[model samples]
Target: MPATLPLDLFLGALVTVGLLAYLTYALVRPERF
Candidate 1:
Protein backbone atom coordinates (compact mmCIF):
# COMPACT_ATOMS: atom_id res chain seq x y z
CA MET A 1 0.00 0.00 0.00
CA PRO A 2 2.78 2.41 0.91
CA ALA A 3 4.67 1.64 -2.31
CA THR A 4 1.59 2.34 -4.40
CA LEU A 5 1.44 5.88 -3.07
CA PRO A 6 4.87 6.74 -4.42
CA LEU A 7 4.11 4.98 -7.66
CA ASP A 8 0.93 6.95 -8.16
CA LEU A 9 2.73 10.18 -7.38
CA PHE A 10 5.46 9.40 -9.86
CA LEU A 11 2.96 8.55 -12.59
CA GLY A 12 0.98 11.68 -11.89
CA ALA A 13 4.09 13.81 -12.13
CA LEU A 14 4.96 12.18 -15.44
CA VAL A 15 1.48 12.83 -16.80
CA THR A 16 1.67 16.43 -15.72
CA VAL A 17 4.99 16.89 -17.39
CA GLY A 18 3.78 15.19 -20.55
CA LEU A 19 0.68 17.34 -20.72
CA LEU A 20 2.72 20.49 -20.22
CA ALA A 21 5.13 19.48 -22.90
CA TYR A 22 2.32 18.66 -25.31
CA LEU A 23 0.65 21.97 -24.64
CA THR A 24 3.87 23.83 -25.21
CA TYR A 25 4.42 22.06 -28.47
CA ALA A 26 0.89 22.72 -29.61
CA LEU A 27 1.27 26.39 -28.81
CA VAL A 28 4.58 26.66 -30.59
CA ARG A 29 3.61 24.74 -33.74
CA PRO A 30 -0.17 24.99 -33.64
CA GLU A 31 -0.45 22.21 -36.25
CA ARG A 32 2.48 19.83 -36.12
CA PHE A 33 1.65 17.93 -32.98
Candidate 2:
Protein backbone atom coordinates (compact mmCIF):
# COMPACT_ATOMS: atom_id res chain seq x y z
CA MET A 1 0.00 0.00 0.00
CA PRO A 2 1.16 3.47 -0.80
CA ALA A 3 1.28 6.09 1.94
CA THR A 4 -0.13 9.57 1.31
CA LEU A 5 2.37 12.41 0.95
CA PRO A 6 1.46 14.07 4.25
CA LEU A 7 1.47 10.78 6.14
CA ASP A 8 4.84 9.76 4.74
CA LEU A 9 6.35 13.13 5.54
CA PHE A 10 5.02 13.12 9.10
CA LEU A 11 6.33 9.66 9.78
CA GLY A 12 9.68 10.47 8.25
CA ALA A 13 10.01 13.58 10.35
CA LEU A 14 8.98 11.69 13.47
CA VAL A 15 11.59 9.01 12.94
CA THR A 16 14.25 11.55 12.10
CA VAL A 17 13.61 13.50 15.27
CA GLY A 18 13.63 10.34 17.36
CA LEU A 19 16.96 9.24 15.95
CA LEU A 20 18.34 12.73 16.35
CA ALA A 21 17.38 12.86 20.01
CA TYR A 22 18.90 9.47 20.59
CA LEU A 23 22.09 10.47 18.84
CA THR A 24 22.26 13.72 20.82
CA TYR A 25 21.93 11.86 24.09
CA ALA A 26 24.53 9.32 23.09
CA LEU A 27 26.94 12.05 22.02
CA VAL A 28 26.52 13.97 25.25
CA ARG A 29 28.53 11.31 27.11
CA PRO A 30 32.01 11.13 25.59
CA GLU A 31 32.40 7.53 26.67
CA ARG A 32 29.10 6.56 25.10
CA PHE A 33 29.49 8.25 21.76
Expressed as tens digits, the lDDT of each residue in 1-33 for candidate 2 is 556568788999999999999988888976975
lDDT of prediction 2: 0.86
**How many steric clashes between backbone atoms does each model show?**
0, 0
For every candidate, C-alpha RMSD to the true structure in Å: 3.5, 5.0
User: Candidate 2 vs. truth: CA RMSD?
Assistant: 5.0
Q: Write the per-residue lDDT of candidate 1 for residues 1-33, one digit (tens) a residue.
A: 464668788999999999999999899998785
lDDT of each: 0.88, 0.86
Give TM per candidate.
0.76, 0.64
Worst 10 residues of 2 by lDDT: 1-10
The best candidate by lDDT is 1
